[model samples]
Target: MKLEQVSETTWAIVDASTYGNVGCIKLPKSVIVIDTGMTPPLAKKFRKLIHKEVGEPITDVILTHYHSDHVFGTQVFQDCTLIASSAMAAIYPELLNNRWSPEGIQELKEYYVQNDPAFAEQLKDLRIITPTQTFEDSMTLGKENEVHIQHTGGHTAGHSTVYLNTERVLFAGDLVFCQQYPYAGDQTNNPLEWMRAFEEILKMPVEIIVPGHGPLCGKEEIQIQLAYFKKLETWIKAQLSEEISLEKVLQTVDSSPTPPYDLKADPRLKFSIERWYTFYSQDEG
Candidate 1:
């Protein structure tokens, strides 16, 4: 993992060997973490690093969503106030009883062991720590209200973004995938809401964006992602008009117009396309 200073009071832990990206905002008396790393060990190390670099107690850990990559590491911050959108918080019980159950976790570790033994080992003592506090639409933090967390509902029904009011920086969970295609295959993913979220971000005074993945970027990346979603929506609408089957549409998506980003072979391409196609199909039906 690498830490890059974003602004006067903001910093991001980018290029994590794992998938998710996490960040922090330095406040007067304490620090607020954006998202925890992908695992307990990673988050433990991150906690230490934050203390060493910022020299302040971590008072709050704000989660952008309930994805394991972003919230799995939250175990290390159990002592702090863990926060998330009410919609996200509502999913915890189901996730805990199902995917995050001991049996389910064992299955996940076994699956990862074949591909990444190191990460699997880290999951040996894995535990799911749900948020203690929840917010409906938006919440403000800091004595001066410097941090603002808002529900955007795009990548997932409970997805959100954290904005540093004074810094003009946005911690855009999975909403903006900097240089690569995003994973939009979540069952609750909504292309229309995602597009609206992008439009809202574009109107912000944001000068810097800490994406859920990839290196730090700016509003240009948001514009690219928004345009890509618009293009995909247009294509899906045309296919629906022609009465194309969802399966056939997925098969032919590869031949559709190329995205603006150069990573055409991104593994997430097909997953995103399938989900968006399904969403549009159901809507049209």
Candidate 2:
């Protein structure tokens, strides 16, 4: 909910510990939103803040990926042009029909209400909103390379990262988890490609980075994240030779090849290990 102005035209909600970082950029005539918050109420609050403080109506909302935390709040911005990767757009129907269906959303509300009764009313009338615009590779907004959106899949098949050409600020989405552990278990994720994306990022002259779920950082944090994944891949490859059950593999990984990064209380170590194990196991098989 806290906003920090990164540059003259860029501002970010740096409180990813509370929710995914939402941001807005000033264009020639209007503002472009980076990612909406995880829920309707949160998104509404962000929309109102942009208008109140930024003094510009949101003309476009560029989603980094299709993760519910990033895209689920798009309904509030239905009036704006919603943009995403073609891969993310392709999965919208399935997400709407199953994962983000009204029934599925209601179930989530019920689970949260069990812990906090006041959450029930806040989740009312929640619905999925798919992107209206999509691109296969890269897209530019405004003139002279001010804003650039490029499809960079590693976190997910359709994930995209935004780059501000003039400022050298990259909105890395889930590709860079900053100081925290990243979720690496999605069926669409490509860990090797994700690592390659890191190398590409290092090559860039990004002065500031806005990660999907962490604080504002620089290239060193990206290096740490890359190192973490490499260590994970090495552990998975080492275990691929063992003729053990998946559960046993999980247990063994849980105990050894200690993760190279700082683990939050809810670290994705088991999930990352399982995902890499499955990926490598298929190759070995």
Candidate 3:
């Protein structure tokens, strides 16, 4: 767990490497948390850190999206108000029943333990909680230290982001993947929608973009990710024009947006390609 003070009132807590990041800002009366960490223990650690820095109690836990990595820690902030997009709220029941059940969460924790023991230990005392407040398009909080939460659907149907109106900082959620491979698979995952979200982001008066994963970044990462998606689209279109089979497309299309990274071998990368291929192929038809 690494924390950086972006400003006197704003801070970013970056998890180990590619894990989801959390953001917090000090308001006149309380601290506003963007997202809890991936698990209870990690969220507890972040909660403690924020209390120490802000010297105030958390007033709200604003969820960026419904992904387990972002919202699974909701249990720790028990007393604080929980907030999320209406779209996310609409899907929470489904996610809880199908994806985030105790068995499902335990399986994911075990997988993480297999991959990295240190990170998985945070899964201990796991408790799942849902948002009590939700909005459709956008919402605002604070009088002096204002923050804006906007619905930006790209990564998911209900995906949203946080904007510090005064600080000019954007907690971009998964709308922008700084250095990690973007997991572009979900019932609502659409690369085009994701790109459109970026266009909207470009117009915002933001200087720093703390991505959902990877390190804290700037706008240039948005450009690079956009380029990646564009290249991916072009590659898929060319393959379709050749009348190639899906398997052949998988075989020939270069999945890596940059060199030396064999993204084709990564499961998330494969899922992303398959999802994009299916969507574009149907749209082209």
C-alpha root-mean-square deviation, candidate 1? 1.4
Ranking by TM-score: 1, 2, 3
Compose the digit string of candidate 3's lDDT tens values, residues 46-76.
Answer: 8887877766878898998888778777898
The top-ranked prediction according to TM-score is 1
Off by over 4 Å in 1: none
Selected candidate, larger lDDT, 1 vs 2: 1
Whose TM-score is higher: candidate 1's or candidate 3's?
Answer: 1
Q: Tens digit of lDDT per residue, candidate 2, span 1-285?
A: 767788778888878622778888888888999988777888888777777778687898999988877776788999999999998789878876886788777788888788766656656667777889999988999777689998888888889999997888898888977667788878777887788888998999999998888788999998877777777777677777666677888766555555445473445667776777787788832
| Total backbone clashes of candidate 3, pairs 3 or more residues apart or in separate chains | 0
What global local distance difference test value does model 1 have?
0.86
Candidate lDDT (C-alpha), each: 0.86, 0.80, 0.79
**TM-score result, candidate 2:** 0.93
* Position 258, candidate 3: lDDT: 47
